[model samples]
Target: KFAAELGRGDKVRFAGSTADLKISEVLSDAHAIADDDPDLETLPSSEHALPSEPATFDVMKRVDQKVVYEKVLDELASGGTLGIFPEGGSHDRTDLLPLKVGVALIAYSALEKDGLAVPIVPVGLNYMRGHRFRGRAIVEFGAPTYVNPDTLDSYKRGGADRRKACNDLLEEIEDAMRSVIVSVPDYEALQLVHTARRLFQKSPNVDARDKQDMSRRFAEAYKQLVARAGTDPPQKWLDLQERLLAYRRELSDLGIRDNQVPGLDRERRHAEAGNYDGDDVLGGGRLLYHIVHLVWVLCLAAIPALFLNIPVGILARVYSDRRRRKALAASKVKIHGRDVVLSE
Candidate 1:
């Protein structure tokens, strides 16, 4: 559908899973090997455990995920796109869960081995009132970020350092997603989790209604923050901080303890990860390109329609005339017998 809309028929090539194909010699030669081995350690332990119950079986399934991370890193290092859901699985209208560190490792390895930086683009997929049918969806591509080895080395040298870096990168991605797409505020989300935990602890017999109330409160807080922080602001840094604080308050009001807030952890990770500023979310550059493309498209359609004597050309002329008349009327300070005095 996208290809047809874009008039790019037969130009789009869809590839199946890269893992199924044998790696070419040239690509294999460029692949990097990572030292991380957590996947290997967890695999055997999972297999040995008895799956007597459903919960036990679920545990085994989680253990199996270790290999996926390792494989993704290897593929990325080999100059291939590793499609990963930072959140392990799909959820209904939830902001992204804390990003798994697997993509970070892949980026680090790729930079170290090939000196080639891979772009991690956040894709937002939204469904309308129903899951299917004609619905509007928008996909915005974020500016690319590279993982440097010198940067990674600094984090790897210290446990605390690495965790801090990881968190920062995750936050950057979250911010990027939020800029182009609708997402739950991080602080409010964390508060929701905290509220749920506290309620569970206090009343082991908590009902579904209590859980619903806690969720509703958190959502309300997020809405308030978004409203207070207009989408367009003069200073994004100050605006973001203010919005974050508002979101934090929302969480606080939901019985989430101050000590439980993840702000400190988020800051620490951002520093360690060497998080950098991204391009403006709504800048003149993209707008200019879109305008130019639209003009070109209009010209193309106009010429073809006029040459073919299609009714569209007539409609376009009428539409253009109406727009011009409206503009003229809007600029008029006074009008006397169709002779209008336009405001200078």
Candidate 2:
């Protein structure tokens, strides 16, 4: 469910070699075992789930300091943009984790080498529902941070001086990354904010032109709400959240979605125009037409679903599971649909 944005460039250069890019190059974390004395079959696991489909591998040769610095130096020297995700690995979390220091070190070292004008761009991957199939995602790119030659000089000083310079640079990157992400205080807030955004878009003030714009607006709104609430959210906000969650829960129990509700403004317009009937309203000739249309569609869909999708899905799970002793665990946020199929 992760999304990322890169600045326009002449060519895209992957950070790793061709060998490390395969789907089964590395094993997942789900297969780790603990060795207890003479016994080596202990299979207790941790909470973290790595990515399932994509094989995880450490492109150690590319990441090595000498190699990485030389490679990046050469790229920049030839007017190339080197993209890197400083998080090292992906996991399911609302907030951004501590960035790898390698990015800062690279920029600093590059600046020192030949005063290369390197810019560290912080991009945020905002997923509406990460784990769900067809879930929406938005990529927000923050301002480009240019390397400070003086900062590199401090790094050259060695010891605490070097550490402080690097830390400061890392902090800057973190702040930039945070600016674009919808980082709520907790899971409850995350749900509340999402629910609110879906409902509140009915208001005239909120524009629905683009998902990315909506994300930015939501981030701004959440920031303001946090500011107003201080240590604790207002009781009114809490009450509203409770109501929204309750409504959502009731819909879930009935096997319906919020968008399926008849009262939705978009649904109302369609109903009034007589062009379509909301899924919530099951009466009228339109409903019968829809039912018939759906049946035929499903009948046609079954062919591909059975022969193509089912076999491929089964083969994928079986092959990945057999080749590795571990399950690849990855965390994803989901929104909108119930069509989620977890990656094994």
Top TM-score hit? 2
lDDT of 1 by residue, 1-344 (tens): 22222221111111210011111121132232223323223223322232344321010011344577567667776667866676543333334443556666656555656666778776655322222223444455556555554677655665656755655666666666554444454434544444444443455455544544454455556557566867853486456556656765776687765445565678789778875445543565788899999999999878866777767646655665565456444431111211111110
Per-residue alpha-carbon lDDT of model 2 for 1-344, expressed as tens digits?
11122111111112221111212222233332211211111111221223356543442222236776788888887789888988765545565544667788878877888778688887777775665556776777878887676677789998678877887887788778876677764556677677666666664444333444565467668768878898899898778768988987987898976556655767678768887545545566678899999999999979867887888878875655543333222222212112223444
- Per-candidate local distance difference test: 0.48, 0.60
How do all models score by TM-score?
0.36, 0.62
Model 2 TM-score on a 0 to 1 scale: 0.62
